[model samples]
Target: MTNEQLQIRVEQISHDFFKKPFIHKAYFNNRLRTTGGRYVLKTHNIEFNPKHYEMYGLDELDGIIKHELCHYHLHIGGRGYKHADADFKNLLRTVGGSRYCRSVKPEPVRTPARYMMLCQNCGMKYMRKRRMDTSKYVCGRCKGPLKLYKMEEANGTQG
Candidate 1:
Protein backbone atom coordinates (compact mmCIF):
# COMPACT_ATOMS: atom_id res chain seq x y z
CA MET A 1 0.00 0.00 0.00
CA THR A 2 1.00 3.60 -0.48
CA ASN A 3 2.31 5.77 2.32
CA GLU A 4 -0.93 7.76 2.28
CA GLN A 5 -2.92 4.59 2.79
CA LEU A 6 -0.61 3.43 5.57
CA GLN A 7 -0.89 6.78 7.31
CA ILE A 8 -4.67 6.60 7.16
CA ARG A 9 -4.68 3.05 8.45
CA VAL A 10 -2.39 3.93 11.33
CA GLU A 11 -4.60 6.87 12.26
CA GLN A 12 -7.71 4.74 12.12
CA ILE A 13 -6.18 1.95 14.12
CA SER A 14 -4.89 4.31 16.77
CA HIS A 15 -8.32 5.86 17.16
CA ASP A 16 -10.31 2.66 16.99
CA PHE A 17 -8.06 0.43 19.05
CA PHE A 18 -6.13 2.72 21.31
CA LYS A 19 -8.75 5.40 21.81
CA LYS A 20 -6.17 7.98 20.80
CA PRO A 21 -5.16 9.90 17.71
CA PHE A 22 -1.88 9.25 15.95
CA ILE A 23 -0.79 12.58 14.58
CA HIS A 24 2.55 11.38 13.28
CA LYS A 25 3.45 9.78 10.01
CA ALA A 26 3.35 6.06 9.16
CA TYR A 27 5.06 4.87 5.98
CA PHE A 28 6.74 1.90 4.33
CA ASN A 29 10.49 1.74 4.79
CA ASN A 30 12.30 -0.59 2.45
CA ARG A 31 15.53 -0.21 4.42
CA LEU A 32 14.06 -2.03 7.41
CA ARG A 33 15.70 -5.39 6.90
CA THR A 34 14.85 -7.46 10.00
CA THR A 35 12.26 -5.60 12.01
CA GLY A 36 8.61 -5.78 11.00
CA GLY A 37 8.16 -2.19 12.10
CA ARG A 38 9.70 0.43 14.36
CA TYR A 39 8.49 3.51 16.22
CA VAL A 40 10.85 6.49 16.24
CA LEU A 41 10.95 7.97 19.67
CA LYS A 42 12.26 11.31 18.47
CA THR A 43 9.85 11.87 15.61
CA HIS A 44 7.00 9.63 16.75
CA ASN A 45 6.85 8.29 13.20
CA ILE A 46 6.24 4.62 12.45
CA GLU A 47 8.07 2.78 9.71
CA PHE A 48 7.00 -0.64 8.37
CA ASN A 49 8.96 -3.12 6.32
CA PRO A 50 7.29 -3.41 2.93
CA LYS A 51 8.47 -7.02 2.64
CA HIS A 52 6.36 -7.94 5.69
CA TYR A 53 3.18 -6.72 3.99
CA GLU A 54 4.20 -8.33 0.73
CA MET A 55 4.80 -11.71 2.32
CA TYR A 56 2.30 -11.78 5.20
CA GLY A 57 -0.46 -9.38 4.05
CA LEU A 58 -2.71 -7.01 5.98
CA ASP A 59 -3.40 -9.19 9.01
CA GLU A 60 0.31 -9.45 9.78
CA LEU A 61 0.73 -5.82 8.92
CA ASP A 62 -1.94 -4.88 11.43
CA GLY A 63 -0.25 -6.92 14.13
CA ILE A 64 3.02 -5.12 13.46
CA ILE A 65 1.25 -1.80 13.63
CA LYS A 66 -0.26 -2.81 16.93
CA HIS A 67 3.16 -3.73 18.25
CA GLU A 68 4.60 -0.41 17.21
CA LEU A 69 1.55 1.39 18.57
CA CYS A 70 2.14 -0.06 21.97
CA HIS A 71 5.56 1.56 21.88
CA TYR A 72 4.16 4.78 20.48
CA HIS A 73 1.37 5.23 23.00
CA LEU A 74 3.35 4.24 26.04
CA HIS A 75 6.23 6.52 25.10
CA ILE A 76 3.86 9.41 24.56
CA GLY A 77 2.23 8.81 27.91
CA GLY A 78 5.62 9.10 29.65
CA ARG A 79 5.21 5.60 31.06
CA GLY A 80 7.36 2.49 30.84
CA TYR A 81 7.68 1.86 27.09
CA LYS A 82 10.61 -0.47 26.72
CA HIS A 83 9.94 -4.03 25.68
CA ALA A 84 10.70 -5.32 29.20
CA ASP A 85 8.69 -2.68 31.03
CA ALA A 86 5.51 -3.43 32.97
CA ASP A 87 3.47 -0.62 31.39
CA PHE A 88 4.41 -1.78 27.92
CA LYS A 89 3.44 -5.36 28.70
CA ASN A 90 0.14 -4.37 30.30
CA LEU A 91 -0.82 -2.07 27.45
CA LEU A 92 0.19 -4.62 24.83
CA ARG A 93 -1.87 -7.32 26.49
CA THR A 94 -4.82 -4.97 26.97
CA VAL A 95 -4.78 -3.98 23.32
CA GLY A 96 -4.12 -7.53 22.15
CA GLY A 97 -1.13 -6.31 20.16
CA SER A 98 1.49 -8.70 18.92
CA ARG A 99 4.05 -9.56 21.55
CA TYR A 100 6.84 -9.01 19.07
CA CYS A 101 7.32 -7.86 15.50
CA ARG A 102 7.27 -10.77 13.07
CA SER A 103 9.97 -10.84 10.43
CA VAL A 104 11.05 -14.20 9.06
CA LYS A 105 14.63 -14.60 7.93
CA PRO A 106 15.20 -16.11 4.51
CA GLU A 107 16.92 -19.48 4.45
CA PRO A 108 20.14 -19.86 2.50
CA VAL A 109 20.14 -22.39 -0.34
CA ARG A 110 23.09 -24.65 -1.15
CA THR A 111 23.16 -25.68 -4.81
CA PRO A 112 25.18 -28.62 -6.02
CA ALA A 113 27.86 -27.72 -8.53
CA ARG A 114 26.36 -28.15 -12.00
CA TYR A 115 29.54 -27.57 -13.97
CA MET A 116 31.82 -30.49 -13.17
CA MET A 117 34.68 -31.99 -15.15
CA LEU A 118 35.74 -35.39 -13.84
CA CYS A 119 39.30 -36.61 -14.24
CA GLN A 120 38.61 -38.92 -17.15
CA ASN A 121 40.80 -41.27 -15.09
CA CYS A 122 40.10 -40.61 -11.36
CA GLY A 123 36.36 -40.70 -10.52
CA MET A 124 36.06 -37.42 -8.58
CA LYS A 125 33.03 -35.09 -8.35
CA TYR A 126 33.09 -31.27 -8.38
CA MET A 127 30.34 -29.09 -6.91
CA ARG A 128 29.97 -25.37 -7.47
CA LYS A 129 27.26 -22.72 -7.57
CA ARG A 130 28.67 -21.24 -10.78
CA ARG A 131 29.53 -23.09 -13.96
CA MET A 132 33.27 -23.78 -13.86
CA ASP A 133 35.28 -24.24 -17.03
CA THR A 134 36.34 -27.89 -16.93
CA SER A 135 39.49 -27.10 -18.99
CA LYS A 136 40.59 -24.44 -16.45
CA TYR A 137 39.73 -26.14 -13.12
CA VAL A 138 40.33 -29.64 -11.67
CA CYS A 139 38.83 -31.53 -8.76
CA GLY A 140 40.71 -30.48 -5.61
CA ARG A 141 39.94 -33.79 -3.87
CA CYS A 142 41.97 -35.84 -6.38
CA LYS A 143 43.43 -33.24 -8.81
CA GLY A 144 41.49 -35.22 -11.40
CA PRO A 145 40.09 -33.80 -14.62
CA LEU A 146 36.60 -32.39 -14.04
CA LYS A 147 33.49 -33.27 -16.07
CA LEU A 148 30.32 -31.17 -16.32
CA TYR A 149 27.36 -32.91 -14.73
CA LYS A 150 23.61 -32.32 -14.89
CA MET A 151 22.45 -29.37 -12.83
CA GLU A 152 20.43 -30.24 -9.74
CA GLU A 153 18.12 -28.02 -7.72
CA ALA A 154 19.58 -26.83 -4.42
CA ASN A 155 17.61 -27.23 -1.18
CA GLY A 156 16.47 -23.63 -1.37
CA THR A 157 13.66 -23.79 1.10
CA GLN A 158 11.94 -20.73 2.51
CA GLY A 159 12.10 -20.22 6.24
Candidate 2:
Protein backbone atom coordinates (compact mmCIF):
# COMPACT_ATOMS: atom_id res chain seq x y z
CA MET A 1 0.00 0.00 0.00
CA THR A 2 0.98 3.63 -0.40
CA ASN A 3 2.29 5.91 2.36
CA GLU A 4 -1.02 7.80 2.22
CA GLN A 5 -2.93 4.58 2.94
CA LEU A 6 -0.52 3.68 5.73
CA GLN A 7 -1.05 7.05 7.41
CA ILE A 8 -4.84 6.68 7.21
CA ARG A 9 -4.72 3.14 8.55
CA VAL A 10 -2.44 4.07 11.43
CA GLU A 11 -4.64 7.02 12.34
CA GLN A 12 -7.76 4.87 12.19
CA ILE A 13 -6.19 2.07 14.27
CA SER A 14 -5.00 4.54 16.87
CA HIS A 15 -8.45 5.99 17.21
CA ASP A 16 -10.30 2.69 17.12
CA PHE A 17 -7.98 0.69 19.38
CA PHE A 18 -6.12 3.20 21.52
CA LYS A 19 -8.94 5.77 21.73
CA LYS A 20 -6.35 8.39 20.73
CA PRO A 21 -5.46 10.20 17.53
CA PHE A 22 -2.15 9.62 15.79
CA ILE A 23 -0.84 12.95 14.62
CA HIS A 24 2.46 11.82 13.09
CA LYS A 25 3.19 10.05 9.83
CA ALA A 26 3.21 6.33 9.06
CA TYR A 27 4.75 4.82 5.93
CA PHE A 28 6.01 1.66 4.32
CA ASN A 29 9.80 1.30 4.43
CA ASN A 30 11.11 -1.37 2.07
CA ARG A 31 14.60 -0.97 3.56
CA LEU A 32 13.41 -2.47 6.87
CA ARG A 33 15.08 -5.84 6.64
CA THR A 34 14.33 -7.58 9.93
CA THR A 35 11.52 -6.00 11.90
CA GLY A 36 7.94 -5.99 10.68
CA GLY A 37 7.51 -2.44 11.94
CA ARG A 38 9.29 0.29 13.89
CA TYR A 39 8.18 3.32 15.90
CA VAL A 40 10.61 6.20 15.65
CA LEU A 41 11.08 8.07 18.93
CA LYS A 42 12.29 11.31 17.40
CA THR A 43 9.77 11.61 14.58
CA HIS A 44 6.91 9.79 16.29
CA ASN A 45 6.46 8.02 12.99
CA ILE A 46 5.64 4.37 12.41
CA GLU A 47 7.44 2.53 9.60
CA PHE A 48 6.14 -0.81 8.36
CA ASN A 49 8.04 -3.21 6.19
CA PRO A 50 5.90 -3.79 3.07
CA LYS A 51 7.58 -7.15 2.56
CA HIS A 52 6.18 -8.21 5.91
CA TYR A 53 2.63 -7.65 4.64
CA GLU A 54 3.36 -9.52 1.41
CA MET A 55 4.86 -12.44 3.29
CA TYR A 56 2.59 -12.69 6.34
CA GLY A 57 -0.61 -11.01 5.01
CA LEU A 58 -3.00 -8.54 6.57
CA ASP A 59 -3.54 -10.21 9.96
CA GLU A 60 0.17 -10.10 10.80
CA LEU A 61 0.40 -6.50 9.56
CA ASP A 62 -2.46 -5.51 11.84
CA GLY A 63 -0.74 -7.05 14.84
CA ILE A 64 2.52 -5.30 13.95
CA ILE A 65 0.69 -2.00 13.63
CA LYS A 66 -0.83 -2.54 17.04
CA HIS A 67 2.59 -3.27 18.49
CA GLU A 68 4.09 -0.06 17.10
CA LEU A 69 1.08 1.92 18.26
CA CYS A 70 1.68 0.72 21.80
CA HIS A 71 5.07 2.39 21.73
CA TYR A 72 3.73 5.52 20.03
CA HIS A 73 0.84 6.15 22.41
CA LEU A 74 2.79 5.37 25.57
CA HIS A 75 5.79 7.50 24.61
CA ILE A 76 3.56 10.48 23.72
CA GLY A 77 1.78 10.34 27.06
CA GLY A 78 5.08 10.32 29.01
CA ARG A 79 4.48 6.72 30.11
CA GLY A 80 7.05 3.94 30.21
CA TYR A 81 7.11 2.83 26.55
CA LYS A 82 9.92 0.31 26.73
CA HIS A 83 9.17 -3.37 26.18
CA ALA A 84 10.30 -4.19 29.73
CA ASP A 85 7.97 -1.65 31.28
CA ALA A 86 4.68 -2.66 32.96
CA ASP A 87 2.72 0.10 31.21
CA PHE A 88 3.92 -1.02 27.80
CA LYS A 89 3.17 -4.66 28.60
CA ASN A 90 -0.35 -3.87 29.78
CA LEU A 91 -1.10 -1.70 26.79
CA LEU A 92 0.23 -4.31 24.41
CA ARG A 93 -1.88 -7.05 25.94
CA THR A 94 -4.93 -4.82 26.00
CA VAL A 95 -4.55 -4.00 22.32
CA GLY A 96 -3.63 -7.58 21.42
CA GLY A 97 -0.37 -6.37 19.90
CA SER A 98 2.51 -8.66 19.09
CA ARG A 99 4.92 -9.09 22.01
CA TYR A 100 7.93 -8.81 19.75
CA CYS A 101 8.67 -7.37 16.33
CA ARG A 102 8.33 -10.15 13.73
CA SER A 103 11.51 -11.06 11.92
CA VAL A 104 11.97 -11.83 8.20
CA LYS A 105 14.00 -14.60 6.63
CA PRO A 106 17.47 -13.24 6.03
CA GLU A 107 19.43 -13.53 2.82
CA PRO A 108 21.89 -16.39 2.63
CA VAL A 109 25.39 -15.52 3.84
CA ARG A 110 28.45 -16.00 1.61
CA THR A 111 32.05 -16.05 2.77
CA PRO A 112 34.26 -15.47 -0.26
CA ALA A 113 38.02 -15.76 -0.35
CA ARG A 114 39.35 -12.21 -0.12
CA TYR A 115 42.93 -12.84 -1.13
CA MET A 116 44.61 -15.06 -3.73
CA MET A 117 48.28 -15.89 -4.20
CA LEU A 118 49.83 -17.19 -7.41
CA CYS A 119 53.21 -18.86 -7.84
CA GLN A 120 55.39 -17.11 -10.45
CA ASN A 121 57.03 -20.28 -11.79
CA CYS A 122 54.42 -23.05 -11.32
CA GLY A 123 51.29 -20.90 -11.74
CA MET A 124 49.78 -22.63 -8.69
CA LYS A 125 47.02 -20.55 -7.09
CA TYR A 126 46.02 -20.29 -3.38
CA MET A 127 42.99 -18.76 -1.70
CA ARG A 128 43.00 -17.12 1.74
CA LYS A 129 40.66 -15.21 3.99
CA ARG A 130 43.37 -12.73 4.95
CA ARG A 131 46.32 -11.26 3.07
CA MET A 132 49.46 -13.41 3.37
CA ASP A 133 53.19 -12.64 3.38
CA THR A 134 54.10 -13.94 -0.10
CA SER A 135 57.84 -13.26 0.47
CA LYS A 136 58.01 -15.58 3.52
CA TYR A 137 55.62 -18.28 2.24
CA VAL A 138 56.85 -19.60 -1.08
CA CYS A 139 54.80 -21.90 -3.32
CA GLY A 140 55.04 -25.48 -2.01
CA ARG A 141 54.74 -27.03 -5.49
CA CYS A 142 57.60 -25.13 -7.20
CA LYS A 143 59.26 -23.18 -4.31
CA GLY A 144 58.69 -20.08 -6.41
CA PRO A 145 57.96 -16.49 -5.39
CA LEU A 146 54.23 -15.83 -4.90
CA LYS A 147 52.35 -12.82 -6.29
CA LEU A 148 49.28 -11.74 -4.35
CA TYR A 149 46.02 -10.54 -5.91
CA LYS A 150 42.61 -9.64 -4.43
CA MET A 151 39.62 -11.78 -5.43
CA GLU A 152 36.15 -10.26 -5.30
CA GLU A 153 34.17 -13.50 -5.67
CA ALA A 154 34.91 -17.03 -4.43
CA ASN A 155 33.53 -18.26 -7.76
CA GLY A 156 36.98 -17.38 -9.24
CA THR A 157 36.54 -13.92 -10.70
CA GLN A 158 39.99 -12.33 -11.08
CA GLY A 159 40.58 -9.10 -9.18
Candidate 3:
Protein backbone atom coordinates (compact mmCIF):
# COMPACT_ATOMS: atom_id res chain seq x y z
CA MET A 1 0.00 0.00 0.00
CA THR A 2 1.04 3.62 -0.43
CA ASN A 3 2.22 5.86 2.38
CA GLU A 4 -1.10 7.72 2.47
CA GLN A 5 -3.04 4.46 2.88
CA LEU A 6 -0.57 3.29 5.51
CA GLN A 7 -0.91 6.55 7.43
CA ILE A 8 -4.70 6.27 7.33
CA ARG A 9 -4.59 2.63 8.41
CA VAL A 10 -2.22 3.35 11.29
CA GLU A 11 -4.36 6.22 12.49
CA GLN A 12 -7.47 4.07 12.30
CA ILE A 13 -5.90 1.17 14.16
CA SER A 14 -4.61 3.47 16.88
CA HIS A 15 -8.07 4.93 17.39
CA ASP A 16 -9.89 1.59 17.17
CA PHE A 17 -7.56 -0.45 19.37
CA PHE A 18 -5.79 2.00 21.67
CA LYS A 19 -8.47 4.68 21.84
CA LYS A 20 -5.77 7.19 20.96
CA PRO A 21 -5.26 9.28 17.86
CA PHE A 22 -1.97 8.82 16.04
CA ILE A 23 -0.76 12.22 14.89
CA HIS A 24 2.53 11.20 13.35
CA LYS A 25 3.34 9.89 9.91
CA ALA A 26 3.36 6.23 8.90
CA TYR A 27 5.05 4.92 5.78
CA PHE A 28 6.73 1.92 4.18
CA ASN A 29 10.52 1.84 4.52
CA ASN A 30 12.08 -0.34 1.86
CA ARG A 31 15.47 -0.25 3.63
CA LEU A 32 14.10 -2.26 6.56
CA ARG A 33 15.47 -5.76 6.16
CA THR A 34 14.90 -7.62 9.43
CA THR A 35 12.03 -5.82 11.16
CA GLY A 36 8.36 -5.78 10.25
CA GLY A 37 7.86 -2.24 11.58
CA ARG A 38 9.49 0.32 13.81
CA TYR A 39 8.19 3.20 15.96
CA VAL A 40 10.62 6.07 15.85
CA LEU A 41 11.06 7.52 19.32
CA LYS A 42 12.32 10.93 18.23
CA THR A 43 9.82 11.66 15.45
CA HIS A 44 6.94 9.45 16.69
CA ASN A 45 6.69 8.15 13.14
CA ILE A 46 6.12 4.50 12.25
CA GLU A 47 7.90 2.71 9.41
CA PHE A 48 6.78 -0.62 7.99
CA ASN A 49 8.48 -3.19 5.83
CA PRO A 50 6.53 -3.57 2.56
CA LYS A 51 7.87 -7.09 2.16
CA HIS A 52 5.77 -8.20 5.14
CA TYR A 53 2.52 -7.08 3.50
CA GLU A 54 3.57 -8.57 0.16
CA MET A 55 4.49 -11.91 1.67
CA TYR A 56 1.96 -12.29 4.50
CA GLY A 57 -1.01 -10.11 3.45
CA LEU A 58 -3.14 -7.59 5.37
CA ASP A 59 -3.68 -9.76 8.44
CA GLU A 60 0.03 -9.84 9.17
CA LEU A 61 0.37 -6.16 8.27
CA ASP A 62 -2.36 -5.28 10.76
CA GLY A 63 -0.59 -7.28 13.43
CA ILE A 64 2.63 -5.38 12.73
CA ILE A 65 0.78 -2.06 12.77
CA LYS A 66 -0.74 -3.00 16.11
CA HIS A 67 2.66 -3.90 17.50
CA GLU A 68 4.15 -0.54 16.46
CA LEU A 69 1.09 1.33 17.74
CA CYS A 70 1.67 -0.21 21.16
CA HIS A 71 5.06 1.48 21.22
CA TYR A 72 3.68 4.73 19.85
CA HIS A 73 0.85 5.07 22.35
CA LEU A 74 2.87 4.03 25.37
CA HIS A 75 5.77 6.31 24.52
CA ILE A 76 3.45 9.27 24.01
CA GLY A 77 1.69 8.60 27.32
CA GLY A 78 5.07 8.68 29.13
CA ARG A 79 4.97 4.99 30.03
CA GLY A 80 7.44 2.15 29.37
CA TYR A 81 7.33 1.42 25.63
CA LYS A 82 10.14 -1.07 25.18
CA HIS A 83 9.39 -4.71 24.34
CA ALA A 84 10.62 -5.91 27.77
CA ASP A 85 8.41 -3.51 29.69
CA ALA A 86 5.19 -4.71 31.36
CA ASP A 87 3.12 -1.91 29.83
CA PHE A 88 4.27 -2.64 26.29
CA LYS A 89 3.76 -6.38 26.71
CA ASN A 90 0.28 -5.91 28.16
CA LEU A 91 -0.78 -3.50 25.42
CA LEU A 92 0.59 -5.81 22.73
CA ARG A 93 -1.28 -8.77 24.16
CA THR A 94 -4.48 -6.74 24.49
CA VAL A 95 -4.22 -5.71 20.84
CA GLY A 96 -3.19 -9.22 19.72
CA GLY A 97 -0.03 -7.95 18.10
CA SER A 98 2.74 -10.17 16.83
CA ARG A 99 5.72 -10.59 19.19
CA TYR A 100 8.10 -11.24 16.32
CA CYS A 101 7.91 -10.90 12.55
CA ARG A 102 8.56 -13.88 10.29
CA SER A 103 11.76 -14.03 8.28
CA VAL A 104 11.48 -12.58 4.79
CA LYS A 105 14.45 -14.39 3.26
CA PRO A 106 16.55 -17.48 3.90
CA GLU A 107 20.10 -17.45 5.18
CA PRO A 108 22.80 -17.00 2.54
CA VAL A 109 24.84 -19.96 1.33
CA ARG A 110 28.58 -20.12 2.11
CA THR A 111 31.04 -20.34 -0.75
CA PRO A 112 33.16 -23.46 -1.10
CA ALA A 113 36.87 -23.33 -0.28
CA ARG A 114 38.99 -22.64 -3.30
CA TYR A 115 42.46 -22.79 -1.77
CA MET A 116 44.26 -24.83 0.88
CA MET A 117 47.38 -24.12 2.89
CA LEU A 118 49.66 -26.75 4.42
CA CYS A 119 52.33 -26.13 7.05
CA GLN A 120 55.53 -28.06 6.31
CA ASN A 121 56.73 -28.47 9.92
CA CYS A 122 53.51 -28.78 11.99
CA GLY A 123 51.30 -30.48 9.37
CA MET A 124 48.55 -27.90 9.99
CA LYS A 125 45.90 -27.42 7.31
CA TYR A 126 43.88 -24.33 6.51
CA MET A 127 41.06 -23.86 4.05
CA ARG A 128 40.17 -20.54 2.41
CA LYS A 129 37.68 -19.34 -0.14
CA ARG A 130 40.20 -16.97 -1.73
CA ARG A 131 43.93 -17.06 -2.48
CA MET A 132 46.30 -15.77 0.22
CA ASP A 133 50.00 -14.89 0.20
CA THR A 134 52.07 -17.77 1.67
CA SER A 135 55.40 -15.86 1.78
CA LYS A 136 54.32 -13.58 4.65
CA TYR A 137 52.20 -16.02 6.65
CA VAL A 138 53.37 -18.75 9.07
CA CYS A 139 51.69 -21.61 10.91
CA GLY A 140 50.43 -20.69 14.37
CA ARG A 141 51.47 -24.00 15.87
CA CYS A 142 55.11 -24.18 14.75
CA LYS A 143 55.96 -20.97 12.84
CA GLY A 144 56.56 -23.18 9.82
CA PRO A 145 56.46 -22.13 6.18
CA LEU A 146 53.07 -22.47 4.48
CA LYS A 147 52.59 -23.91 1.02
CA LEU A 148 49.51 -22.79 -0.92
CA TYR A 149 47.73 -25.40 -3.02
CA LYS A 150 44.60 -25.32 -5.12
CA MET A 151 41.68 -27.14 -3.49
CA GLU A 152 41.29 -29.46 -6.50
CA GLU A 153 44.98 -30.39 -6.34
CA ALA A 154 44.74 -31.01 -2.58
CA ASN A 155 41.70 -33.21 -3.21
CA GLY A 156 43.64 -35.31 -5.76
CA THR A 157 41.50 -34.04 -8.67
CA GLN A 158 43.47 -33.20 -11.84
CA GLY A 159 41.82 -30.58 -14.04
TM-scores of the candidates are 0.69, 0.66, 0.75
lDDT of each: 0.83, 0.88, 0.93
| Candidate 2: worst-modelled 10 consecutive residues by lDDT | 150-159
Q: Give residue 69's error in model 3 in angstroms.
A: 0.3
Candidate 1 to native Cα RMSD, angstroms: 7.1
lDDT string, candidate 1, 58-152, tens digits: 99899889989999999999999999999999888887888866656788887646553446567765556676668887667777776665454
lDDT per residue as tens, model 3, 99-127? 99998986889899999999999889999
Candidate with the larger TM-score of 1 and 2: 1
7-117 per-residue lDDT for model 2 (tens digits): 898899999999999999999998988788889999999999998888878888889999999999999999999989999999999999888655688677978788889
Error of 1 at 85 (Å): 0.4
* The candidate that achieves the highest TM-score relative to the unseen native structure: 3
If both were scored by TM-score, which would come out higher, candidate 2 or candidate 3? 3
Ten-residue region with minimum lDDT total, candidate 3: 150-159
Better of 1 and 3 by TM-score: 3
| Highest lDDT scorer | 3
Q: How accurate is candidate 1 locally (lDDT)?
A: 0.83
Local error of candidate 3 at residue 20 (angstroms): 3.1
